[model samples]
Target chain A: MNRKLRDLGERRLVEWIVRRLEECEGASLPPGDDAADMLFRGRLLVSCDMLAASTDIPPGMDLRDAGFKAITSATSDIAAKGGKPIAYLVSLMLPPELGLESFEDLWEGFEEAAKLYGGRIVGGDLNSGREIVVDVICIGEAGRTASRLGARPGDILAVTGEFGSQAAGLHALLAGRLEDPEARRVVERFSRPMARVREALELAKTSAVTASIDSSDGLAESLYQLSELNDVGFLIDDPPISAEAERYAEKFGVSLFDLVFYGGEEYELVLTLRSKLVEKAVKAVEGVGGRLIPIGRVIEEKLIKVRWADGWRMLERRGYQHF
Target chain B: MNRKLRDLGERRLVEWIVRRLEECEGASLPPGDDAADMLFRGRLLVSCDMLAASTDIPPGMDLRDAGFKAITSATSDIAAKGGKPIAYLVSLMLPPELGLESFEDLWEGFEEAAKLYGGRIVGGDLNSGREIVVDVICIGEAGRTASRLGARPGDILAVTGEFGSQAAGLHALLAGRLEDPEARRVVERFSRPMARVREALELAKTSAVTASIDSSDGLAESLYQLSELNDVGFLIDDPPISAEAERYAEKFGVSLFDLVFYGGEEYELVLTLRSKLVEKAVKAVEGVGGRLIPIGRVIEEKLIKVRWADGWRMLERRGYQHF
Candidate 1:
């Protein structure tokens, strides 16, 4: 633990990671091979996600959470495509001064997330940089996928899970308020987000979802993206706001609407399905130990509107921007 | 061109990149989709390679060269595995102060490398970081590969191309002696290295090669690795030293042996084949417009030796260490 990465060197660091990798099923090449080999006979889904310490890791978050979040974010893309993740390639850019313990924590987080998502951490690249950067490439497979351009007017708009918790959690962490249970829950949501891979995979089996998008960007921004791509609008009567987030917002006088709509990193799926097949979709999610929360309905008006206490309010087209 | 990434924002930057992507073959989903989709029916090879600005891009090299090298390095892994690359997913961590023109150059280099390697740049992720970092994930297909652990005694050791040019080139570039033609040639080798993908692919078809490894980590180091893995030794009677490198070494009073064995980033392939099947392997490589240079033979004893001018000399197991 006292040794830094510079002392361990890149080759030994790779050896350490190889020692921790669980035997990857169906992997023809061993863990330390130059490349990971997997035989498949279907559609292949590929996505890459990057997270850096400067912008991604908040003050309260650690390297382990950063690594987990990086994998989760990449898996969320696969889930949104209705694909099951099979393997991952992680490329890390680490500062020379990073300690071996921190590096181990990061790898542990990667292992934990891969176990949770049923994928193998097959192979990756490592280099030296000014700060820690984790880039995860997810390889998945699926028979069919729900695309953002497939939405139709009169479809039910739903989410895989509640929102606003991540936003509220970020706020609570920033304010250093973890004494309250609700605040702690929200903070945990913000720190260690989970991908909706199981729910999306099960829902896809029903073939009821017309369109899908990952809500890593704010929920409102995801709605706007789907609207633009499908040339449709949404009328959201019930936003899937979290109960813990609600209590925290009420106690802190925070805007619940903003928290639910504008907060990002939710890792949920904002999707649409035929209103008639709602029962089937709900049953599929429930079968997988998940729940589908209906938030609104797709419309042809080309505008997003939310039913608030006073009247319908227009949702802006904005989300988290990297730069 | 004058605008910085911070001013352009992440959304517009992504849009610009999407606009620049070529028409990807067999891509079920469009360019801007969250994940790239492809259909295949064989063994899949996955590898990732990362290059950072501080570590990878030398003083004279630009972002475009860095991007190209990043892709080339990753493709080399696939080549060593005897795989044909199908698609690439690039993830970039850029500094906010980077210029738009530089970013364009980087993308252009990626496009150029993809074209040269006969693959599509399907999808990628972008994020802000402390410096420029390009992590490319190569998804490829292969029928079979030559493993490093397959070498046997009396196997003829060979290389796909000459060496020492890259090391000499780097020295020339660092010494600011590009005015000389030989120096410039060596420098070009250092700056723009090509992967032995075609040669390795063709050689893999012969079914005569026993072991293979990409020699990017220097020729001597590659031999040492193959030796250790196969529990064998090599008697290197001949070193494939480039003429230009030899000239540069003489002119600069540098050791030719060191230049040939210790200089890294050659991007060549070191392999071992049965002496009787050498003709078949040579024919296959030549058919693909590449040459196979015979170096020596694998020995039963587990030691690496080079036939130096004075006598046989033991080669150290050392190469580039990132830290």
Candidate 2:
């Protein structure tokens, strides 16, 4: 735990990985943001992820969550790419201290998560090492990939489901806020994130959407990616926060807007859509059992401005601090 | 460091990786073995390995040798499979303490090594981590892979180049025996190991080899593997030992047999050949500039024995220890 993991952070590490893997004959994008490209085979998608326990996943809440979170984590990227999860790989790094029970629970969670989504857990690794580093690389095919750069200046900004609940809920739970049974919802939000694969696919097929990104890191970070890629500004009106978030925000003494903007692990999607077909886009997303809430619109200026009744202000941090 | 990698040792980590990387349409042997299978455009063979400082490469070796050795380390497996390298992916995980000079030196060594081995350093990843782990993932094509299980009872044991040089050379360098410049040969053997790709390929083209495994893990381990795979026996009259091996034996007070039979990182091909193709095989490999040394013969029984002055004896502990 004392080891600082000196040198390149995740961003730089990812950049390096992209560069190397992309050189392979089938590597999708050399190295950059989001997910790597898969040479589409079946309409289904598969994604992979590796998490070093010391560096990636924190100390336990539930072991099964490892499996569930792994699946959901991969599925979230699939959702961002406007693809459906057909299957996933789960290479679990088991430390020597672990037991058979943990492995069984991990597999169980994997099965549960897959059934929750539409995919199944296929084959993966069971490697041992100094640290617990779980790598899950997935395969995904897109009907149409929703790139972050696809947003136009006038595109309508949107989000799937509510924001900030997980952040507030996590904070409250950490602060011994177990008095509220609904705190389980927030914990579950973090533990069992649902990838909006169907919604992403449906939206991608429509003419209404422009750009999309998964809100794994948080709303601000996802939006920053969209703006940076598209070279556009966002005039966002803070979207409606969840009830759990408002209560948890008060209990944790953290700002509701902060939770909405900077809180991460939401696994929801923040998307930009064509202004003229905003209604159509919403309908398309909702048609697939996903809620699309219009949060803002793209502006000509090269800034992500938060516009409220009081005044217009600049966001201090545009995205999630993944590193 | 004391931990067995599979018992949360390297094997466990590898299995964890396998689980996470679970089979997509493209990924092969996910996170298992030396390298994972990649679905590149061609019938490509790719493997990535990370060399650690203390564990893999001893401290203070030349950057060029490190680079050369890295390439050799990977190419050896391909050679065993009777494959020709097309290209390499080099990921040099540097400690932050290292600077531009070290990087340049490493790059120079890497480029030169790649060039010498007929592979291009197409791309790489540079990141800071705990140890200096240089991962080299090589991609090659097979005319016919000299798999581990192809040998039969009558197959003759063969090798390329002299053995025991690397271990003895390393010992001399570590003991400051540089005054004996002959030790340089062994040192060079370790630092600048060349793959037996040429020999493997030539053998494959002639269809002379029954089974093959790189002698990197030494003749004893290879014999054990080949015998196990073919359900045969191995009887070596006098396995090849490097020049100065006897001197090293005297200096270190170790049995010369131990260094030659069980020592590793040789990177020479321990190919199994039919008794009939001895001359043709020798000519075939020598024509490709790979000198073939026929060492022993296979037997009907399943015992793997080495001949000594007294009689034949079975080896106890098998081969090289990467840990």
Candidate 3:
């Protein structure tokens, strides 16, 4: 118990999986969250997101926060396309000498988060580790999946929350520059980044959104993804950065724009819509208390170029990769 | 490169995940697996399992085996209800210093198992570890789930494959009795278990399977589960043990019957059928090279008692709980 998860091996970690599920989340026949038995009326469209240790997690975090963030990663994917997440399942592979209750409590935390966002923890896998890897699969219903490909010329770009707070906080935490109350905010955001499932659901219900993506991989990368999916170019403007990020950048001499443009792990929803419905789209999310801020517009050109207060150039490699 | 995965923390480790999942699988919308999207149908089933290093995984195993085993733990739930697995996702939080490529290679193995079983993985999360944990979620589809609540007193009990091999092989490996070729089969069963999704699918084509439960939580425990659901009793006969298990039990001075009866994680299909179509049911699984051995029948009594060659007694501690 004295050792961290990094000191463990694969077989030694994932040995705690019980053979049978303990309970169900709903009255429906199928299980919920990670343990699911969904009845689909049509052809199924599914996807999985696997998060490894280093790139996605903040260091020295609690198991509960890690569990929350883990669900957030998968839920973010579900939120981007206007899907209502039905349930979530998780596979937690822990190191051999791990305290058993740590995982049991963590599983409960994961379940709470799923319920908080209107999803259930249905089922999951537990295995030992080369490293601690948590893989989440979220299932949702779709009349039509809002994709990044729907954006076209003149479509406006928007996000659900302020950018760069998590990024700047992450930078400050790593750089040892975070101080006092600001440190708590930055640390909290860094540790428990939330998914925008409710926001996406609201957008989908209104049918005003054209394209969408989450901010886990940063702004420019998501814009590029939208451009690729829709076969249209983008001219994203200066994104709205958090006041905390501005202050932290000033204190640490970090670039505020870089955090706004290319920082990762925000878990916010980035979407596109026609300018005509921009007000409606903004109102739809606001009624649900979900923020929607205009960032820029889709362009006719085939390249994604950003415009700041200064000048602009073609953007490249805004975030991370898993391969 | 030869280092193991347990030493890595969250940040360095998640970077490893970002590298592995650049391409989306079975995406329903654009920017697939990057954030939340539409649910593919009307509902989803969900669950989570925690893999313990000391209890779930055996020592001296390949990293890829962890990935393979993780899939089995999740998919077995789907198989229990005759659900077709559609997609899977994962979340990984690792200890500091875990090798990233080890994750890549393991993912390749996990992806291969899913493909072999006719499922795909789409998204996941990677973070740093205080302990290494791998959590997987599998999504499945069924017309009408063969629930545990449907069994009657006249139903016949059946199973798909021989049991006890994984327990015996794991015991041998842990106790240092493994040798080439002879030890390989047992070890393979332990390291690379398969879910009975195909058999479950075939079972779903008919209503003959009145109630079903996989023997993952040991045959005894699964029987109790069905009894609880149907509010009836189970009269299970002697379950089949593998030839390898028989040999290992003799060498290790343990009871082969005990292992087959009480051991879990066989990943085999089990169901309760009406006695009227027992012949047709046997033919059904046999037609697909999946054997349906009648181990017992459901009873009207409320107690779940099993019979051996000699006598019958009340069962104790029906299944294995990894905690």
Top candidate on TM-score is: 1
True contacts kept of 1: 0.82
Which candidate do you rate higher for DockQ, 1 or 2? 1
Query: Tens digits of per-residue lDDT for model 3 on B30-130?
Result: 32345433334543444445564445656777668877877777787777766766666665554545565766666776777778777666555554545
Deviation of model 3 at B46, angstroms: 5.0
Q: Give residue A259's lDDT in candidate 2 (0 to 100).
A: 84
> What is the lDDT of every predicted structure here?
0.86, 0.63, 0.67
Query: All candidates: CA RMSD in angstroms?
Result: 1.6, 10.5, 6.1
TM-score of chain B of 2: 0.82
Query: Which tens-of-lDDT digit does each residue in A132-235 have in candidate 3?
Result: 45676666555567766677788888888888888877776676654567656777777778888777878887777887778777876777667766788877
Q: Best lDDT goes to which candidate?
A: 1
What is the C-alpha DockQ of each candidate?
0.78, 0.08, 0.29
Higher-scoring candidate on TM-score, 1 or 3: 1
What would the per-residue lDDT of candidate 2 be over residues A1-323, giving only the tens digit for each residue? Answer: 22222232322322332342222224322222111222323343334444444433545456688677767776787677676665454444344455546655666777787778776443332323355444443445565455555677878898888887877756665666556766666766666667787778778878676777778768777776667667888998766587777776676578888888887778887888888888888898788888889988898787888864488868765443211
Ten residues in sequence with the least summed lDDT for candidate 2 chain B: B28-37
How far does residue B255 in candidate 2 sit from its true spot (Å)? 3.8
Question: Which portions of model 1 miss their true places by more than 4 Å?
Answer: A22-26, B22-25
TM-score, chain A, per candidate? 0.96, 0.81, 0.85
